[model samples]
Structure formats: structure tokens, C-alpha cells
Target: MRKKHEAPLDTLNSYLPVGAYHTVMQYLGHYKVHLTITKERRSVLGDYRFAVHGKNHRISVNGNLNAFAFLITLLHELAHLIAFEKYGNRIASHGKEWKLVYGEILQQFLLLDLFPPDIANEIKTTMRSPAAGSCAEDGLIRVLRKYDRKGDVKKLVEEIDVNGLFRTDDGRIFKRGDQLRKRIRCLEIKTGKIYLFSPVYEVTPVSHP
Candidate 1:
């Protein structure tokens, strides 16, 4: 069977409103960040990797990702760029710096109220709840349901949590990547580092009709 071709960035670019696109560019400039988005298998829903040779950066979003997921992934990667630019190597991978930026960006995105009422409600609920193991399953469900809904899918886009998925362990909350990608609260004996894993599933963002 022939391999299916993924949609190009330019094709996706046409779907984005000029205002939103420019806003993203402005935010990128504020952090002196440069990134290229491509269709690839990121370890998670989205992946942000820095370039080794240049000031350039790269963000990979799954080729089959829906519009909402794509937008959220872009924002999530932006949070990483902002955190790295501001804190350098001082902050933990999914530490306070990331949380601050994530919250701020989330707030900005929500202010636009671009999501559907139901999905927006879910986003608000998830934001308020502590990141616990129980929430991931339900959160994933809510995100997926909103994505699959037809008509005015852009309304559901705001519901995607781009910054990163959160998970709870023993009442303590940690963002995805704090541990391994599957086992929660997995410990590394040598480094004494904590790992937050990503939820093992794929969700498509809802498309606007």
C-alpha cells in the first residue's frame, strides 16, 4: 500500500484566522523563539525539540491531529519555548516555570472564548481540579468527545490543553513528562528524579463545520 501524504503546514495555515496567527507570531517574537511545525510522531501529542546547530526550533504534531489538537499542541510547545527562554536551565522540565507560563497562556486563549460551551466548561473544570490519576481518563474522554463533535469545531479548540496533560499521584499533582510516559510516579534511583507520564491514547480535535 502506498503511504498516505500528510497535510502540509500551509494547508493547515489557511484554516487559522489571520488575527490568531499573528498573535501567535507576536508571542513567538516576545520570547525570541523560532519553530517549524511538521507532521511527525511526537512522543506525546506534541513535542518541542530545540535545534542543535541553530537558533531554530521544531514542533512535531501528529499528522492526523485534528484542528483543536493542532492548536493546543502549538500553544503547548510555545509554553516550553517561553519557559526555556526565561529560565534557561534553572527550572525543572515540568516545574514552576512551565506551570506559570501554561496558566498564563491558557488564560489568554480562554479569554478568546473560541471553544464550544461544553468543551469550554470541561476545560475550566479540568483546570480547577488537581491533577490526579483519575482525572486523566475522564479528561481524555472529554477532550475526545469534544473533538469528534461536528459543526463549529473551532469552538472546541479552546478545550485542548496544549501546555501539557496533568496527572496526580498520591494526592500530588504533576504535569506529563514528570515521570515515564505510562507508569505514574515512577522513580529513578540514580537521579532521584520524578517522572510524569503522558496518557496513553490519541485524541483528535473537533473541526469547525
Candidate 2:
């Protein structure tokens, strides 16, 4: 068990960047939350686990996320922690209470100039009233995408050209096809099977033209 005043973020400096460490440290201290960074999650960017079975309240975020994304994901899960603190999980996940807490947390960063101007402005607009699904907010995504670490980054559905060959991190290759509602139709190059991929799905375009 951590000492009563132990700096929680100290345990995370290896996973978090210098720019984001201070804010997250402060948040952890305030909430007395236990944080863990696991391998990149397949389903969600972050998750919050309520205290149970004598475990300390815990929050976990993917390890590979860029700094901005890491911060927002942390805050999103932290907002859940705060919501549970105020009103147990009896309320809906994204109800008005959760929205209020989410917005409140973002407001602190905006007011403190923690983020770049563009991102801060985008967050300000989106947090006027937090959306039910954090992933569905375009303004926030636009700002966060700008900060994505640019090394051989994968393309999302919108970035993939028709007939292009794209591969996932796990090396599954697919050919971009037509759009189908919210998902884009794709053909797995090796399997020769059609699949629908989320627009936000990350993929590296392997063959162009």
C-alpha cells in the first residue's frame, strides 16, 4: 500500500511524458486513485475500476497513447471515478451528473493553460456539455488527432484510399472498399473475406495505387 502522501504519479513517469506528468500527479493525489498502465487496450482507451474486495480505486489507460490522448483518456476515466464518488454507479454512465464532472475536469485544464491553444479551444467547445460517448465527439477528436505521434502512423478509415492495402498493428492486411454506414467495408487481403471496420480504426496503408 502506498503511504498516505505518496506521489501517485511517481509510479507512472516511465509511461507518461514530462508534459503530462504534473497534471496527472495532481489528479491522482486529489482522488487517491491507484493508476496502472497496461498494454494497449483493444476495446477502450481507458477504464476505471471502482474499489472493491479491499482493492484501492484503480484507473488504467493504454500505454502507447500520445501525450494529449493519454491526458484526455485519463481524465475521462477519472471523471468516472469522480462520478462514483458523488453518486455511486446507480446513475447512467453518461448522465447529466457524469457530464458535469467531465466538463468540470476539462475546465481546469482550459483555465490553467495546460493544453495548447487549439486543443484548449476545441475542448472548451466540446465540454460546454459533455457528450454521452466521449469517442463520438468530433471537435475533441480533431484536436487530439493533431497530437498523435507521427512515426509510421496508421490511417483511419477516412484516410484510407479506395483499393488501398492497409495493415493493422497485428499485421492483418485489408484492402479498403466502399463505405457502409458508420463502418467502411474492407477486404482482408490474406483471408479474402469482407469486413466492416470502424472509421476510427487504426490501419497502416501498405499498398497505395
Indicate which candidate wins on lDDT. Answer: 2
Q: Write the per-residue lDDT of candidate 1 for residues 1-209, one digit (tens) a residue.
A: 21224335346565343335656667755655544445444244556665456656655454445555556566767767678878885677567786677657756877786666665566566455323222233564456445643653222212334433322222332222333334434333334466543344332332221
Local accuracy of candidate 2 as per-residue lDDT tens digits, 1-209: 21122224556765554566777778788887887775645656777888888777888777667676777788888998899889988888888888899999888766666678887777888787776654446567766777777774666776888888888767788888998887899998777899998777767778642
Candidate 1 Cα deviation (angstroms), residue 196: 16
Error of 1 at 109 (Å): 1.0
Candidates' C-alpha lDDT: 0.51, 0.75
Candidate 2's C-alpha runs over 4 A off are 1-8, 11-23, 129-136, 169-171, 180-182, 189-194
Going through the candidates in the order shown, the clash numbers are 13, 0
